[model samples]
Every structure is written in structure tokens, then in C-alpha cells.
Target: MKYFFFMLAAAPLSVCCQTLVHAQVISKSTQQAIPFATVGLVKQNNGTTTDEIGSFKIQCRSIEDSIIISAVGFKTARVAVSVVLSARKIELEENLVLLEEVSISWRNKAKPTTLNDFVHCPTNYYSVGLGTYRQVAQRFLAPRASMRLQSIRLCKMAGKATFRVRVYAMDSITGMPSTDLLSKELLINSSDKNVYIDLQENIVLPDRDFFIAVEWLFISSNEFRVKAKIDRQKISYSNYAPRLSFKKLTGIPTQNNCRMLNFNGSWQKPENYDSNHVFMIAAELGSQ
Candidate 1:
């Protein structure tokens, strides 16, 4: 299966349709605008993200359709379509939680270990859709002893689009992405095929499974219009560039090799997703 992605511009915008409702997302405490927040309806499989000024226009299908709004560093908010249309501003409370301190003894190890190294293969990558925060992630089992993350590496398909990197610890019970690992934003803008990102500071990786994901930023600089046929109808939409590289391999476990998409601000494993096309994202860990 192939993946395609589209980007929404960061601007005060409006949709011409009468069913579309315009709203703004803001912080409850400071009343500050929260940009790039995703607003979506799961059942309808429809959504849009807030623009630079924290404004967004989403199509309301029915009065009962629930809208889910989510952004990094904020608590997810859910409201019915009728409620969001009636209100001028949607306030999301900040989700502020201190990270647990992970202590690991670096016993003066010499070399750093690299995980998920990819072989030189044909160009194969994945993409996200329009008005969505699609995060492609790869999970790796942490070493028995905790280690420090040195850098992350990936292959860019094309263009020089800037993207964000996120780290999440694997949930013990559910085996899904759980706690946020990297608090600070890690943005990379590069056109080269091979990209390497250094953490700069030491980040402790707990002795559990962890996930590294790439988030697409829907801004003007990364936007490009593309024509595609959906349902046999040719449509034009904004495409985000610099997709992550992938390699096809056989006999991989169903759970080990799959892509996760963020719908309504939640990471979900979409059905019928290709499990053989593994993303070429790797992490380097060391005892520093």
C-alpha cells in the first residue's frame, strides 16, 4: 500500500461551504492561541488543524458529531459540533506533568550502539493526508540498562520541508505510545536525502520499549499543490514534502512493522495498512 500526505497552510482561513464552522483554539489559563492543534471527527474520518493564529474551519456533518482537538503540551478537548459552532473560542487546558527521572549507570562504555540501520535500497517512502497530524513511528526495545540518546537518522524523499521529531515511551500494559520523552521541540529542515539529527543534550532512554516519530508541520513553507484522483475524481490538495524513506522486507511481524496515523489527535493503527514497508528511522544510544 502507498501513503500520501497533504498540508494545511498556517493562516487565518475560511471554507466556502455552509457546513464548515470557523473556530479558534486557545489556552484556558493565559487565553493564548494554540497553533497547529488538530480538530477532527473520528466517525466521519474528517478533520482539520488550527492555523498559525489558532483558527480553523472544519466541516460539521451533524449536530452530534464530536470534535476532538489536540496539540502537543496541552490536554485534548472534545466537544460536539453544535457546541463548537455556537462558541467563538475553544479552550484547552494545559497538560503539565513532570517526567519521571530515569537513573542509569554509564559504566564508561566506549562505543555507541546504533539501532534500525537500513540497507541501501530503492526509494520507498510513506506520506500523510491533508488537515491531519500524521506521525510515522518506529518502536525499539530499550537495552536492559538505560542509555543516553545521541542522535536520530533518516532518509528524506524530496524537497526541504521542516518537520518535528517526538519520542514516546511504549506503554507497558497496552504496548502503545505513552509518556512523552522529549519535552523540547526538535525541528529539522533539510533537502538532502540522508538526514541526521543530534540530540545535543543527553536524553535518558528508560529500560523499556520506546518509539521515535516524525510529525508533519502544516505551514506555508512546506506546502505544495498536487493533483490526485480520489474515487476516480481528480482533486487538488496541498502536499507536504520530504517524506521519510522506507524499505520493503518480508516475514516481519504484523505488530513490528506498521504505520500509525493521528486521527482526532490520537495515534491509531489504521486498518489494511502496509506492514512490510519499514521506515528508515534509527536511533543511536550510548553511555555518555
Candidate 2:
């Protein structure tokens, strides 16, 4: 399905009446909060994410809709919307498993250089979505059989809040983002117009291709409300701040450059993804 994004706000519309629910997600064993956990409606395409404290607020169209709470290293929790409203605290079981080891031997060659698909940066900025936990991923090709990722650079056209960064391995079968490449959370709090993230330690990039994704956190500080119409229905939805910059270019396929991950926990090619436009996110790589 095509998601909505706007460069300019249109005339405000009346907000649609919907059930606003609040809840918290926590680990079942430790009772600690699970931040940024995805809370999606079962069978419904809409949802939101928890804040750093594991708290979340989502507007529901129907109380009968079931809610799915999921995060990495945890078993997905599915509860009825009605139940969630009453419980307010959802517990997800930990599902920890060891990841297969990937060994890379890099040859000392040349100094690190920036790698990007875009030719130049433009003033054009794209709103990935107005929803929480909206993620935009860009694919990058490995220059050699193995390389060390030094850092990432993202041109923030706008925003001053916390956001999460993730690295993923390309799915051999589907060529989509599949598995997490990093072990720990890569959360960054920045109000800078230009965002640069230096990895504490360089991580090995697979010989093939990889992906870098930016996940918008659903926090009070990043709250952005806008009035818009969906499916001929008027409603106000929350869009996050720190808009990622984009520019127009040709020849590069949209699917190969960018993809979107909604609160529903699925990565898809956004209809707004045009081959002529690419997100201005780049990676720095060097030989080990």
C-alpha cells in the first residue's frame, strides 16, 4: 500500500474520532521496559511504537482489533485491543538465540572513503511518513569481498530528537532486509541538521550487499501531528521529526536504493519511492 508524505501542510481537516489507547511493553522475565517495540493491529495495517520507557499510545479504529507487540530478541505478543486498553501493560517473552558467526579477513589496502549512490545532495526533503516507528532503509553494495564500516552520514533536512539506526544483512532469497547485523542498540540523540554516526568499533560488512535503516522513535519530543485524509476519511496522525533529506537522480532503481518499514513490521517499496529521488544517507568504509 502507498503511504502518505507531504512537503507542505495542506488545509487542516477535522480529526476523526477514534479510540486512543495507552500502554507499556515490558520483558516478561526481567520486568524491564522494552523500548521501541512495535505495537501493530492484528490484520490491520496501522500501528505505533513504544518510547524509550516502553510506553506507547496508539489510536484504534475498532476495539475488536487485536494488537501485536514485537521487538528483536523477544517473542511477539498478540492481544486484543480491548484487552490492551484494560491491561495497559503488555509482557513479551524473551526469545534469545545465538547468531551464526561470520568471519571476515580484510587486507590493509587504502584509506577509508565515503560510499554513496547519489551524485549530489538537493534541497528537497522527503517525509518518510507521519506515523511512529516508520523506517527508511537504503541498500549499499560492498566494494570488495570484505570491508569495515567506519561510520554513517545522514543529511537531516529537519528534526531535533532521538532516532534509532540499524544495520541488516540482505536476504539471500528475497534481497530484502532480513537479519540484524549489530548486537547492541544503536540509538542516537541529536538535534543537528546534519547527522553523523561513528561506530564505536568498525563492524565487518559482508562481501555481498547490506542495508542501513533509520527508525523514527515514538517519543513525546518527536511528536508531529498533522491533519490529513486517508481513504476519503479525515484524521490527524502523528509524524516524527528530523526529516531525512533526498535528491533527484536517474538510472538507479527505487527498490535497489530505498525501502520502507511501517509499524506493521514489514519492509515494502513505498509508492512515494521514485527512481529519480534517493535518500541522502551514506556510509564510510575502509579496509581492515
Candidate 3:
């Protein structure tokens, strides 16, 4: 659904009394903390992330919103808002098959540039919500027939966060992302400099160009701002109005291929932004 963003402090009239729940998510088998888990209102496209210790405070908009907690390799736990608000700790069973780690080296004829090669410096940044996304075109020519996307990197500017990574096949008409290459969500934790989300899937690159998108599952807090030459051109990373500033340039087709599902419920380039300030994120590829 198309919707406008609102400030964190602003509440809708439907809010009579909100449910404030403090909870922690951890792995059931290992008893370890599961940080950056997606916890929030189900079907409402609203949520928050657990901190480093797996602790989070969920503010339910209303009792009608079902609360669900999910992670990359864990089973999703869904419960009523009231049921969650009263619980202390929730444990999620692992959905992964744990085997001894093995390393394999594959011989390739050509080695392409690293992920750092495609990424540019960030001119702006934005927070993500349900359906909110930042997209970058994948135009790299790889020698391999198929490769594994091991991890994705996001430059963390603020709070601990998590999002789903999606790789879509290019549309024949608009050259935009048309078909989903993935069946499940690839959850990413943005708290670590070394943090990367494992794709757990194969990227078949046979004259295949695509779009990589980061769709927000949950963002914890808003902590920064950006000001421009004019007062009306101010920019900030806030909920309901999360935005990325365009890098200033004279004229070019654009080395930076980026766009946003902006607050106005439209997919357009950033207003007054020169260079597409998609983000400063990296992706690492592994052997097929």
C-alpha cells in the first residue's frame, strides 16, 4: 500500500493507549542472543530491532496488530501483542542445518572487481520501514556461469537494524527488477562493521543483469540529519520521512544507479539530489 511517512513522536488518532513491551530474543538451542531480530506488528509494516544484547522495546500501535519475531536462521514466533507484552524472554528454534564448516577453492579464469569497485561514497542516507527500499542496478559481467552471493554490507549510521535482501531479474521493458530470484527473505544485521547477510542462494549470471534491493524489516532509532544550501532543502533520516540526499554533480548519465521507494508513495529519484545517493554498502561473492 502507498503511504506517507510520519514523525516518530506523531501518533495517529486511532491510538488510545499503546502497548509498550520489553522483550529479548535468543536462540533456543544455544541460549545465545539473536540481535537485530525483526519484532513488530504483523501485516502493519511497522516494527523495531533488538539491540546487541537482543533486547528491544516494542510499542504496539494498537491491540489489533499481531506481533511477530523473526530472524534469518530461526523459526518465526508469532503471538498476540498482549501475549508478547507480558512475556519475558522468547526463544526461537534454529531453522538451519548445522554441519562442520568446509572450505572449497574453485578455479576460475577471470576475477572481477570487488564489491568496493561498484560502490561510491555516500552523499546521503535513509532509514527503512516496511516496503521502503533502496535499489542498485547489477550490471557486472562475471565469467562464471553461476556464483553464490555470500554476504551484503551496509554502512551503519545509527541504530542496530535488520532488512531483507532481494535480487530480482531485470524487466525486459523498463530494465527494472521484474522477477524475484529468491523465495525467502535474507535478513541482514547492520550493527557490525564486518556484518554481512548470507544470501543462502545462488546467483546465476549468464548474460544476466539484475537489481539488488534492501527492504527494511526494522530500524531501531533515528539519529542524524543533513542540511543543504537552502532551508527548504533540509534532509534527515527520520521515520515517515526517511530520505537520502542526492550527490551534487554537473551532468552525467549517473555512475550511481540508485532510487528509493520514497515517502510520497512513489518510486523516483531523490528530489534535488544530484548523484543517486543509494547507499554505501558492499556485497561479497563466494565460490559456486
| lDDT by residue (tens digit), candidate 3, 1-288 | 122233332233126435677878889999999876767565454556677789877555676667677665677787776766677788889876531211222233232434533344343444443333333333333334365555554443434544456666655565555555554555444444333444444455433355566555344343333222336664444452223222334555555455443322224444444353334455455555
- Give the lDDT of residue 195 in candidate 3: 37
RMSD per model, one decimal: 5.9, 6.1, 8.2
Give one digit per residue, the lDDT tens place, for model 1 in 104-176.
2323333368888765634765565554446777888656557887777787676787777778887777667
Using lDDT as the measure, the top candidate is: 2
Q: Cα lDDT of all candidates, in order?
A: 0.68, 0.70, 0.50
- Runs of candidate 1 exceeding 4 Å displacement: 1-18, 97-111, 119-122, 131-133, 228-237, 250-255
Candidate 3: residue 241 lDDT (0-100):
21
Count of backbone clashes, every candidate in sequence: 1, 2, 4
**Whole-model lDDT for model 3 versus the true structure?**
0.50
Q: 52-92, model 2: which lDDT tens digit per residue? A: 79998877668878888877668888889888888999999
